[model samples]
Target chain A: MNGDLSALPGIVALTLGVGAVATAAMLAPAVALGFCLARGNFRGKALVQALVAVPMVLPPVAVGFALLILLGRNGPLAFVWSALDIDLVFSWWAAVIAAAVVGFPLLTRACEQAFGEVDVRFEQVARSLGLGPLRSFFAVTLPLARRGVLYGSLLAFTRALGEFGATALVAGIIPGRTETLALGIYSRVQLGDESGALALCAASFAIALIAMLVAEGWLRRSRP
Target chain B: MSQRTSRIRCHIDRPGFSLDVDVGWDERVAVVFGPSGSGKSTLFEIVLGLERCAGAHIRIGGSTFDDEAAGLYLPTECRDLGWVPQSPTLFPHLSVSENLDFGRARAADRDPAARKRAIEVLEIGDLLGRSIDQLSGGEAQRVAIARALASGPSALLLDEPLAALDLPLRARVLPYLMRVRDQLDLPILYITHDPDEAQLIGDIIVVLDAGRIVASGAPRDVLWSRAVLPLSEALGLENVFEGGIRREHGSPTFVSNAGLQLVLPVSLDGDTRVRIGLRAEDVVLAADRPGKISARNVLESRVIACDDRDGDVYVSLDAGEKLVAKVTAAAAAQLALAPGSTVYAIVKAQALRRLG
Candidate 1:
């Protein structure tokens, strides 16, 4: 049992590192898409919205397969893939990419709701005060919607921490290399190592609980 | 100060309603008088470039912000104008001083002296540290006005800034607006549905109804015009008149511009121009002259229009001065009232209220 669980610390570090990186990388695109979905009026808006929600509703394995076909080594991106001469499959970056795709819809939906709650009048007032539209959005709208954005990021972080099917297919559970907590637990359970699987589950619960607590505290502090 | 003019010619189409207006004004304070849903706010939005209306031509101080025929359009940020909506929309995440600084920092021709004067005029010096949520309605409006002034705008547009406050708070904030109009050199466009507010602050008045300008002139002239009288009457400024004060029979009498006279209970020491108001329900119309009456003023009038409300009749009378009398339909029928019929308007001394 001890020998099997020796990789627990490595798994924890990998999960935390990949989760944080994925959350950070997803923030900008999520915010932009959220604002557009909430405030913009243009053609193909519904199509864009549906595309964003695809990963959340579709099977995680299916999402991973779709990503594999697009970014895999001899795929349609073969020119750039050969130019870079780098393997994206079975790498830590693959885990980050899978986690980001799975968590994006949740983050964007939360952020869209948040931006929708902010009154457009505040932005108008900012523009009237001589700030341009983009500046007004950054200065007035974003700060006012800070709590929502923070909560969405935390949700995305938690979701990234538990990503299983996509990470398993894309990164392929290499011990001490790309294995996260979920993949480690799955590997232990498949190998009939009940104690190791239970320990990994406990760690996952703790991380999720901490993320929720921080989100709640942030929401409380931001309440006007 | 050199005279400046604002010219606006716009046509906006909305669902179920459209606004088409062309007007110009050089007054220091121009009041856009209209009822709710009169496209007053839409007019402001078009001028501020918040709403797009094609073929619109807007020029202020010789600068063309929007001339659609020439295909030139300026965004709201590029326009040299400040706006205060009906609600005091202070940024909730900021303090009062930060809100004021927001305007000052972005102004192209930022004026520190003007900002300091605005702070002094609005008397918001002590509220600089308070958060936005801590302010009362009146205080928030004062801060909003001062913040707009800090931007050093060439013109200011206020969309019923006092409409959110109660009567006492509105009264408290109105004087600050008056001070801004009197002290500042910029033109101001104040939109309001209340006729009293229009009369009190308007140097020039433009009356709008159903998205069209029905009348435009001096406050007394436009507000008292036949087209605007019914709208003003609905807003509770019925029987409004501009009159000169005079002493007669040891009492003060008000002689109106239409050559009608009324004995007022209150005394004005010297001869001065004053506005007088009487409630529509307070004026009693009598078909026959009564022998013994305690009412102070009685004038011969002709019934011009009678409109049937729920159970009462709104009788518009021309007593040399326009007066509206709300009486029961039974009484109107009993008196056989119709257009061009003679009647006497009996107003008690206490019913006449002096407005500024």
Candidate 2:
């Protein structure tokens, strides 16, 4: 029973790694989509926004099921995965893909609100100063909107840390492979290891609390 | 036309308002003069290529920025014109020095000499280290202008550069504007609603009213022209005189450069050189000098021209310096006002507003 507790560190590390990798994977796409929603005026924008927000509002298990079918062995993309000789389902990467899908909407929405707060005239002035569109975005718009973007990323990362239903359905409870803190807590309770579940719960709470405190401190220090 | 002349033709149609103007000038400094909502800023935006007008043609300093007929239109960045907007739109995230560097980095060719001159001319060398929010309004405006100049633009587009400042700040910033105009040797398109600023700074003036060109010529003539009298009256056009003050019989008197001595309501102090502004409606025209009148500085003058429009007469007077008087048509008829008619101009001491 004491030896089973040795897997605690591996669970915490895998959880942190999944959250970090998921947040990093979605950062660029989220910023681009957020900027487009904030500034672009075109037809069918509402449809695009609604589609992007589906994973956030839908049931997490349902999203995991959808992803399973899309990347499963018998799925339409099975040949592509087989051609690459990569097993996506029930793997560590499957956990990352699930976490990224759920966190994308949160990060993208935050980015949209952040970019909206920036005045368009600043970009116009930048262009007048001889900066092209991309350069102006980096030099003026992105810097001004960095706070909101960072806060959004923090929200998505924290959300990813606690993701259980999707990760459980897709990655399964394979210790040191795909079992994160959330899945480990659930698996320990099923195994009747009450002390192990409580210990994992405490570790999850500590990491989340520390992450939030550090993010708040960093954000406050950056205020101009 | 000279090789460096600027020409612009724009026609914008909108609901309840339309701006249609076709004007050109050979002078290096052209002032777009008009009241608010008269499309003065719109004209500048068109020149800056911020607003695209179909079939419009713009040529400044022998460069064709936009020509619909030629299928050529340069973007705002490629226009190569320095634009100082109404507000000092300095980047809040950057310090003054960074803002200037941002502009300088994009120049076609790096010219350290021009960048140094812009900083020295605006006297913003001390402000380079400060962030935008730490600076006052006047300091921010100077930094904004310097940032535009640091880009090494081909021409300059200044939209009411002094309008955002208060009277004292305007006075402080005017010299820097003059320095940019005099020292830079660049073609400039300036927008201003103030007649005094127009007269003092512009080599030529374009008067716009209700989105149309009412008159375009020399500043004094364009504002005081017969066609622009009604619009100018709405703008509160004032007759400005530059002179020195002297003590006469325990009261201060203003001796204008053209040699007319007039009593002032305010006491003179510190600097003797002063600029004063009088509204056209403030000057009273009488056939004979009144006796024992409360008004001071009654001077004999001859009418240079008489413009009768919209039930009012705009009488141009040459009383050592140019002055305009506005009176009803009935009053002009009673006084028999006409060109070359000698009249006594009655100016009250309190009517003279001190303008620096």
Candidate 3:
């Protein structure tokens, strides 16, 4: 027990930043995929849905290993990374990639459920009012499904903040860099810093609580 | 009138149902009248280009929306026709004004003027600030109509706009629809199962049954035509008489716009102008004027046509206004009824129901 607590702020900031970045990065794709799943009727739809849920159901470590193989040297697309002169392993971006992969299923599932709850008639009415397909979705369908999407985003953000196995595998727990709250807690407990681990736990709990409270307030306020 | 024409020739095949209709009319207001499963809404969907039917030809107000032969099909948004679907589909997330603006924003021309006219004609001005859920059934329908009209469409397509409302609410909303019909010069394609609504709102009634156009012509003539008697009788075809009430000899006398007078069973307190409904079955036909009959009203009417089908005879008559009487085939034969036969239409005052 060194009784040193100076690394707390850096770890908290890195954790929050990683969660925010990863959630932001996945927002558009998740919404698009979710809407497609909710409304589309096509061949191979079941296979697509199953593939989307694979990340959520599979072990996070396995996902990290797969991502590691894809982004690591001596793997496919290795020349692209080498050409770009970028090393992705054990970096902040690697942690974001890991968090995004793990949190994607939660966000997408939420979006699909939310969009499914919206009546297609609203979109049809919007289209009949001279709005194109894209405009109708934004003006009618998306707003109607906002609560579910927002709630799903908060779920993914919290999941990203707590991402441990995937982040640890792809992005090693480097001090003041790739280390987040969950990784910090694991590393602190392993190093016999019980107080540090407890502090990180409290921070995680506080962040999860505040994010949910804000989302609930927003959802209630915007309820039709 | 510019001799506007609306035409729809489409064949839609669905599981356990098929809609094969070819109907066209020169009237500005063409109504698709039918029973519940008669594909009235489906026909509307085809006209709006919402339902894609290959080789379907839909032309409204001289504008072609779908002509599959020419390989041209305008999407629903590009149809440039105001469509009020069967249900009131006001956007729940928006206020009434926002919903109106949603349509007005995309209007090609007369943006503000169209919006203003829609708001005024539908009488939804006071309801503009309210949310959709806060509105009553009638108010929501009015707002829905206004929203459609605000788009400045070349024509309007209404799918049973008053079907969702109760009787009183329908009455309250129908005048707004009538005002829309009278005030706006746009061609209207209205749909309904109610014969009265068909008679009142539609200049040309296209009777549909089993996903087919049974008859299409002038409202009264087509509705009472031999071709439409079976379907119209099943729909409970009602003679809709529009008139005013005045106290004659201490009793309220109902005088229709067409100069037919009748005694009322119940005296209405207020509102002199009213519409009454008389069912075909409620009208009893007598070969001779009955002396000392308990029935309140008796009028001599010339038979236009007698359709004997399914063990009943439907006598189409001209008793000042067009009226129908359903009598047994035996009674029809006993009276030797046929076209140009002089008969008496005995209508009990109690049989008349105040529609509005």
- Please tell me what DockQ candidate 2 reaches: 0.59
Give the C-alpha lDDT of model 1.
0.86
Ten contiguous residues with the weakest lDDT in model 3 chain A: A1-10
Once model 3 is optimally superposed onto the true structure by TM-score, how far is the C-alpha of residue B95 displaced, in angstroms? 0.4
Evaluate model 1: give its TM-score. Answer: 0.84
lDDT of 1 at A146: 88
Clashes by residue pair, model 2: none
Model 3 off-target regions past 4 Å?
A1-3, B1-4, B108-111, B247-250, B265-273, B286-296, B329-343
lDDT of 2 at A34: 98
i-RMSD of all predictions: 1.2, 1.6, 1.2
Encode model 3's per-residue lDDT on B1-356: one tens digit a residue: 22346778899888989999877778899888999999988888888767788779889989988877788889998888888887898899899999999977667564558998998998888999998899999999999999999988888989999888998888778768878988889899999988888888888998888988888888878887778866776776778888888877766778888988778875542357677888888999888899998788898999998888788888888898778888999999999999998999999888887775
After superposition, candidate 1 runs with Cα above 4 Å error: A1-5, B1-4, B238-356
Listed per model, the TM-scores of chain A against the true chain A are 0.97, 0.96, 0.97
RMSD in order of candidates: 5.8, 3.1, 2.6
Q: Considering summed lDDT, which 10 consecutive residues are worst modelled in model 2 chain A?
A: A1-10
Pairs of residues clashing in candidate 3: none
lDDT of 1 by residue, B1-356 (tens): 11246778899887889999998877678899999999999999999999988879887655679988788999999887878988989999999999988877656475657678889989999999999999988999999999898888878899998889887577567768867877888788899998877877788998899999999989855765567777987876656666788888887898888887888886443446666767778999898887789998888999988878667787888888767788999999999999999999999978887654
Runs in model 2 lying further than 4 Å from the true structure: A2-5, B1-4, B14-17, B108-110, B241-275, B286-300, B329-335, B346-350, B354-356
